[model samples]
Target: MDPLTPMITTNPFDDDKLREECGIFGVSGADTASAIVALGLHALQHRGQEAAGITSWDGHDFHTHRAMGHVAGNFDRDEVIRGLPGGSACGHVRYSTTGETSLRNVQPLYAELNSGGFAVAHNGNISNAMKVRRELIRRGSIFQSTSDTEVIIHLVATSSYRTLLDKFIDALKQVEGAYSLIVMTPEGMIACRDPLGIRPLVMGKLGDTIMFASETVAFDVVGAEYIRSIDPGELVIVTNSGEIRSHRPFGEVHPRPCIFEHVYFSRPDSIVDGSSVYSVRKAIGAQLAIENPVEADYVIPVPDSGVPAAIGYAQESGIPFELGIIRSHYIGRTFIQPGDKVRHLGVKLKHNANRALIQGKKIVLIDDSIVRGTTSLKIVQMMREAGAAEVHMRIASPPTKHSCFYGVDTPERTKLLAHKLDVGGMQDFIHADSLSFISIDGLYKALGEAKRADGRPQYCDACFTGDYPTTLTDQDDVVVTNQLELLAERVA
Candidate 1:
């Protein structure tokens, strides 16, 4: 077989060119925002790990601590969080989407905008950033970072709105695609979600204090009471008086949260939109066993993401589960290291296959999704080298054939192997004996009981089906500039 023949490289979309979205957390009315944010970020750390940053405002000024590493590594000493004193603050754990994985891209981006100023933390991607950036450049907006979140900073600075809330609302109106944001001004803290609800944001209460995070699990870690999600198209303000105010920009935009969150992104202990992610993954695994049954000596998950599904598959297929791969918890930001040699070394440092469990065995390997196919190919080779007789691949979800416009960064269709090859072709490409993906219906069913009417229970499957709840328009992509000037003139 010609290696070049199997390589699907003619993608109109650039390969190895996608970016991962980040996670944001903020709290106000608390005695120690730094310590609270550190603990909250620990719970939401799965959302991002490249860098961690926190900004605490002490009435007069903002004190910050930021570094390029895990929360534990970055804030290793108690004095680190304790040093930043404030009643309210905002923090960010970043997975860079546009910028390089350097300390420069780390978040809790603080800027002295208006009278007092604004510090921001953001989750999700802005699809129109390039377009917006070009226009901002024309307006003489000096950008400090390659991060799209910086664009919002520039927009807020230029807005002629009355309050910081007005500027935030105005800035959001021009952006498109997914975003769940947390911003801190001298006066208060603000939390907002996109009109389409592409990402998840929730509100919680810690006595008189108000909290906001990308996941409810963060609130739970801090002993905060869950107080529902920040609704689609909503902007919430938490004042010093502990008052919460809500605003809706486009109330009619359909609520379409990212489906990948339940399938593979979120922790099993976390719940989104009142649905359990663990049960959803397990159900999908059970459904996959029924839809694509296979005879195997043992069921092995790809560790981490595939564990729950593999358990369900084993129970449904009556196959015994085995721990075939061991993952090293001490892996640093290995993905940030450039070069294939470095990346390969990082992989070896992170995961090792157990030869005793896989040797001379017919094994079923279950994973979440195969993106780019590089990692999947390497894993298959690793299994074969470990003496596996035959490796059957089972995917818990359907193929990620399209790039997500929302937070979950994915390459264009041209770069996706599933978009280019059929199941058989994928098997040959990955060097697997066979490969099967769970059907869409089976996936939906495995997600458990989704409320048919939103009152029952439901989920967002836009990644699999591309049935977007809201349409992206040219207006949504328009950059904030003379348009704002015209609006100001009209108001005058």
Candidate 2:
């Protein structure tokens, strides 16, 4: 077998789920800042698995180390942390939603600017990146990587503002999309969220140190006290002397954080938008039971992500909850499949049916969402093979009818199962006896909202409702064509 053979046999159970975007963690005014950042990134490992990088700024120089794997092997070494000697540091873990998975695309992208050395770790997509890239190239700006994040650096470099802070703000204003950024400069560390707040970022404090991360769970890992979420359009700057200042350059706007954070992306224990993600998921499951009632002998979760919702469903429906599917946490994202004969066994490497518990039982399966519906089909078949008399499927979220352009790695609109089929059609495709999903209104109710407003939704539910908050400039046909032409020219 070739060394890369395992890469071809990725876990089928994970393939059908939405890939997490990326994670960023930053610390300022702390001793051994790089080590603290490493710990924080470890806690946020679920957010991104492809690559990890850390950049630290000492009094004089900026030191950076980037690798094409998880943080453990790369940043855990005492020598590695010792080499990045600084009181301030920032790190990023990437899953490559926008850029290709390679060393160059790993973030905390550093550049030496006219102002000084600057580094940035970003957690969302810049929708106008292609458009801006073309314009920058036309104006003689050179790009070092294919990442959309590099565009921010170019924009900052090209800005005519007299001050570094002004240039940073100017660059942010030109881009259109979700972003929660932690920027490190010689002056200090700056953490900011986009005007819409589509992605999550939280502020925390550990003694005299200030920290910023994609999720609050990272703070908990570093023994930091959760401060509050970085407000939409707000920038918080922490100086080397421990002085902190806040600025809101983008002014006030209707904040629309990603609703799926509660549905799937965030760690269950993390708090998002002032609500516990675990509580919200349980609420969603309860709401699902209230809306779609079905009599079944057992309420079985699809595994990991489905566990919370399944518990809620069991509680609300007065049904017994059981571990009908046993998941193997030891299974890596990829495994060796020697030939076609072993390829079909990929799903079993991650999850296996609880044969004894599910045997002869009429079970209701709970899951977070149905993306392509392939995993659901396989799980349903597996249940039947385990002697399940009847299998009904319940989704905790509304049907994902559209693709997400804000950092999440989702299939194209045409590839989404919900986009192509209705409820009955989906049930038939998955070979389930019955299938139901939570309503859009029910999802909002679970989040403590009365219902989704007709005018402007409080959350970014574009995948389910197709109501994107920002303009997707790169998705424009004309801009895409121009971008291709520019790329071809560069290659030629």
Best-fitting candidate, scored by TM-score: 2
- The estimated TM-scores of all candidates read 0.85, 0.94
Tens digit per residue, CA lDDT, model 2, 20-129: 67899999998899999999999999998878999999889999999987898999999999989999999999774332346877889999999999999998888888
Candidate 2, residue 159: how far the Cα is off, in Å: 0.9
Off by over 4 Å in 2: 1-13, 97-100, 337-340, 478-492
Candidate lDDT values, in order:
0.76, 0.89
Collision count for each candidate, in order? 4, 0
Q: Which TM-score value belongs to model 2?
A: 0.94
Highest lDDT: give the candidate number: 2
Model 1 TM-score (2 dp)? 0.85
